[model samples]
Target: MSSTTTSITCTGLTFGWPDGTPVLDGLDLSVGPGRTGLIGLNGTGKSTLLKLIAGELTPLGGAVRVTGELGHLPQNLTLDTSLRVDEALGVADARAALHAIEAGDAAEEHFTAIGDDWDVEERARATLDQLGLVGVGLDRTVGEVSGGESVLLRLAALLLARPDVLLLDEPTNDLDREARQRLYAAVSAWPGVLVVVSHDRELLGLVDRIADLRPDGVHWYGGNLDAYEEAVAAEQEAAERMVRVAEADVKRQRRELTESQSKLAKRVRYGNKMSANKREPKIVMNQRKRDAQVSGAKHRLLHEQRLEDAKERLDEAAEAVRDDAEIRVDLPFTAVPPGRRVLTLRDVELRCGARATLDVHGPERIALLGRNGSGKSTLLRTIAGGLPAVAGEVETHVPVRSLPQRLDVLDDDLSLVENVARLAPEATNNRVRAQLARFLFKGARADRTVGTLSGGERFRATLAAVMLAEPAPQLLMLDEPTNNLDMASVRQLVAALGSYEGALIVAGHDVPFLRDIGVTRWLRLDGELNPVDPEEV
Candidate 1:
């Protein structure tokens, strides 16, 4: 591997979990310089493959080769709370070395630590400012920054390192609209091998190619996500057409087999009658009867073979079509009548120094838009009674439930069924199981413990617990609901929300998702809550 070039290669890669669940087996991949969006449904090993390439995970039976320095920003980010911002950006040691040299220490080790990077602090601050972190100071501790800011800070460290190859797993999970745009600018201008594993459609649209990880292997699409989607749609259409043709062929073959059998039966009856009437000599009649029997057998076998071949073709064609199921939601019990007062906020002060005052009526859907630390989540928590307001009044006329971004509402040891039962105590076990099925947890899936579920699966379980509560929440609030979900799971969430007739307050940066859920009101939380048009954001 040459340091001058940038690339990633995996040959004969095979990996499995400790439980012996195979993910990638005998796989081969080559990613060259450019942005590549690695995408697939949940549990398809998109994240696993990225981890393997980034050396976070070792393959069981293969090798991974990289040509240049690499940097990786994982989905779940953790930073030491006591570390200063400059330390978190990986410039503290260099800054210390520079200071020692300036103080006339004349130490060889300080020079070695500083290297040619004497202005490390300036570069680190510049990187932070590039990612919309101007307000975050160099001396501020990691604990003082918001979660979204922490994500950007990690990215800033990666930028300062200036690796030739970059890997980001769900990089925009916590970014607000403004922060995401800044990150997008960085991705667009990146001049190296950049591979991102994400479900953010806007982020994926910035890639030069699409790497779709499936059960078979990696399928490469020549362009961005939109192009990939178009190619897939065209392929599916052709596959469905072939399936229809194969089905018709099967039907035709079955008809021919039936017709052939009927003809053979008639011929046998005629021959038997002739023999009985002695129309020909006994030896001749016997010979004719044997010949007819052999012919009929050959005809029957040929038709059966044709039908079998057609059915096989049909099965193959059907396999090409995806069967990603959507959630089935029917929550008549959660509906709020028109003109009903659902919630009211009067001069309420939030934990993040934001104030709000509003009245939510009927089944109005509101989108709470804001920057990373603008107090959107705080306002929702105050309304849900999870947090107390510093000033003013908050009231709700109906049962309310809030699904926070952390999704910590469920007990890890409990199964989906048990968790739903805990929430909806009055509902029978049978009834709860039936509702769980609507959330796409059927049979044994419903019995799987929450701890063992994937990110998407756990989200569904949490959503079920809240939506299926005993009194049936007429007012439902969600904080960053689409943060960790795959595209399929996002769609499933939209489908589930389609059936909810309650007043909704959703806080997040996913405007497309908000639009898909039919949000009627758009509000921004930036020190003060105010209404805004959807297009302006």
Candidate 2:
């Protein structure tokens, strides 16, 4: 620790929940100032390590040292209902006092001593402006905003706190294109130590380092996701060699064991034959007895023990160092009708008040691209039956199922199993359980309330429910399906979509993701919700 820099150096840290297996075992980490992206498969100890560094949880064996103030944004954030946006930044108290003075309740001396509401409002506005939220009213309640907006609100508050270390877990999961860019800008400009637990490839590319958490321990590399992936591949190849060597050794030991057993059997046969002849006081017979008991017996026992030990060692060497047994899915199916019109929008208008965004498409894939408020979602909702077509006909033969950006179609209060039950009432409970397992939701996870699920989990559960129906939707409408998913999941989902035979209408700004998922067309919208020319924003 020094005045110029803050660092966390932990050695032999071992921690886990009560009654649960160890998540981090004798782990070591030395993190200093700079952005470090944390990536791992689900159930890894990323969140736990965040809690430990923040001092919310203690290490079971070793100590954790944090040099300065740290601010963390967990996936789920709950704020006090009564607190306003400005109150989060310490300007509300001053504004409240000034408001009282204007109402003639403030003491004359105190009123003159304290600043007025107008002054407080100016300061709050400046702070909000820095966060690109100046246009929004400071009085707006957190509960009134969408999850994406609330996330920014919390980030603003945290940024204003001026902590030395900032940890954000899945921070961009709920953010749209614009907000995600804003987050990237914030981290890129930050001068403090930052650890982000995220699966966003775009975000990962901007980080100074990438650290992967495995079951055994953590490994840090001085590059982004791509470089880490390459290094990991090399390491795995090397690790696999250990298994081959151990296997070879085990085989040799087993052969030796068999030979020793045969030799002992021959000795027993010879001894039994000599005893049957009733040889008495024969020196040769006595010598043969000593050979069988002292030499052959001891050698047989030792060789047998060696073989067992060799087998165990082989098993240990073959233990998992890579999780490559994951499912491989490539959905090669389409729903393009034989006719000229796969889908249509004749005066297809979607409106929120006086604004609208419209689309007219043939039997082709189209990307609806725009800022979050540009009414991209509204257009998709109208097509998927979530919202009525305000003043147009959306003709389509194939069934359309939408993966809304917010995934609001599913009730947040219900568990995944319950939601799936509602979606497919004809299916039995056992059938539903088995179906859920396909989407990686097993047992208790399927029973956990949807409200408690993260954005990624909700998306996975929703996809499982939608695709389980008998008649596949000829048209798939996805609004930012990859927003909350990790990079690997995104790739998997994209690969599936690429092979999809059905018509696709996706609203997302992930350029590479769109390309990977087979975007055959692209459409951009404006803030007025009206159709803008493809070239013009």
Candidate 3:
């Protein structure tokens, strides 16, 4: 690590994805040598910015200069298959160069850059201990670890390299709350220039400053997420006031100029009727000319200036503009047609693996509650006709659509439009585009591969396809719709679900979201379904 403090500075640096819309515009940011959390909505280029700083991506314009060694975890992690935890930190590369140096090979420069380690296994074991993987065998295979565990191991590998600058993207997405706490604690103790892109509000609150990258440009506030939001909110109000004042001044000036012009025309016409010898003095004529130019020209100038000022104000105010008026999509038939036999689960027992049984019934917004691997997903899968029951009967209505948590229903290799089109083979591209627009995926965005979309976008697109089917599914099964959504986006989704008709059997652990969406039925993962509780579900 560099002894001197390292910093990341960008000047007019901007970039976007390959063959994608412009995500950044003339962005400038100066990051001090400390942990700074990146905050932004989808397609805001937060992930792209991290890649620029870490040297994975070259800026399209200007520069991104980081004065230190850098290491990064991309948004997705692809591990070296079956590699032991101890051997995963590029130690083999470190050792091979050491051997080459001793043999008088051309790896001299590599040896100079990477110090010869005492022993590869020793170094790897030490890194594993530091990362809270204390008792796990150093030689354990990566394939044996769980998804969250694998994430922790990958992060540990990056941390072991001891880069002067560390960039992490959505580091906590797969980990549990406790694991996130453990990682955060380690980050707090590290002495490096840290840059992280994440949507976790708690993580955002821990940063030194918050940088928001919107479509317009990039802006940073020297505070936490809450403070940044408050500042942005204040700017929104100030910008609105600026626009209103400029508009009022323009209106007032134009009206006065119109009246003044009328008077001037009358004066000029009357003066022409007078005899040349008897006309007013030259001084009066000059004064009148001066008055006309002052009022008329001043009006034009002020009017033009105000128009420009108003446009600028509008641009700034657009950051938090409430264009999406909370139009409560009033459900045409808010209540489902009460059928005596909505669903029938006869002695149906769901056993995911070694243990776990979950049973539930119809017209229910049943919330399947559990931690990771608690059989919630397995139970929901069976309900959606994904898994075969061991020994039971499960019956549901026709035309059923399910927005699974992972969207297993969606074809990863297919484009979003194609995936939606599978349900209606005759659906034209224009029709598919219109349906996708309601969920905000519109146009070319719908043409992107379904596997490439972020979690939230995928969920929205899946939900859109679900609701737009020919015979709208009377029974909708949603499994953790709010899992990857940011707070604002989650709220928007809850509103959409609230407006949805049909029988919803949502499986989520978000109690507050369940209450807000008017869920009346609750099903515990361990037992049969029950009515929603006033206090807890």
Q: Write the per-residue lDDT of candidate 2 for residues 1-537, one digit (tens) a residue.
A: 354564777788888755344568898888888889988765567777888888878889887887888888876566765667776655666666677777888576545545443576675676566656655677876555555666777788777667888999878765777788888888889888889988777788888889888777787898877888888888778668878887898899989989988888888897878877977557778877887788887897898888888888877777835643232233334446445355666656676432343443334677777765566777778777778866767766666778886577688778788888887788899988887876778787788777655456677778877765535566788887776566666765765565566777888767677777666666776644344344442
Global CA lDDT computed for model 1? 0.90
Q: In model 2, state the lDDT of residue 36.
A: 95
Give the RMSD in angstroms, all C-alphas superposed, for model 3.
6.4
* TM-scores of all predicted structures: 0.94, 0.75, 0.74
True-structure lDDT of candidate 2: 0.72
Deviation (Å) of 445 in candidate 1: 3.0
Instruction: Write candidate 1's Cα lDDT for 119-168 as tens digits.
Output: 89889888888999998998899999988999999999999999999999
Model 1 clashing-pair count: 0
Whichever of 1 and 2 has more TM-score, that candidate is 1
Query: For model 3, how does the per-residue alpha-carbon lDDT over 274-388 read when each residue is reduced to its tens digit?
Result: 4255577877777776776677667666666656665565565554453332213333433365553445565666664423333333345555554434456666677678886
Regarding lDDT, does 1 or 2 come out ahead? Answer: 1
Over 4 Å off, model 2: 1-32, 45-68, 76-90, 95-150, 174-178, 216-218, 222-227, 258-290, 293-304, 328-342, 353-365, 408-419, 428-434, 441-455, 495-501, 527-537
lDDT of each: 0.90, 0.72, 0.67
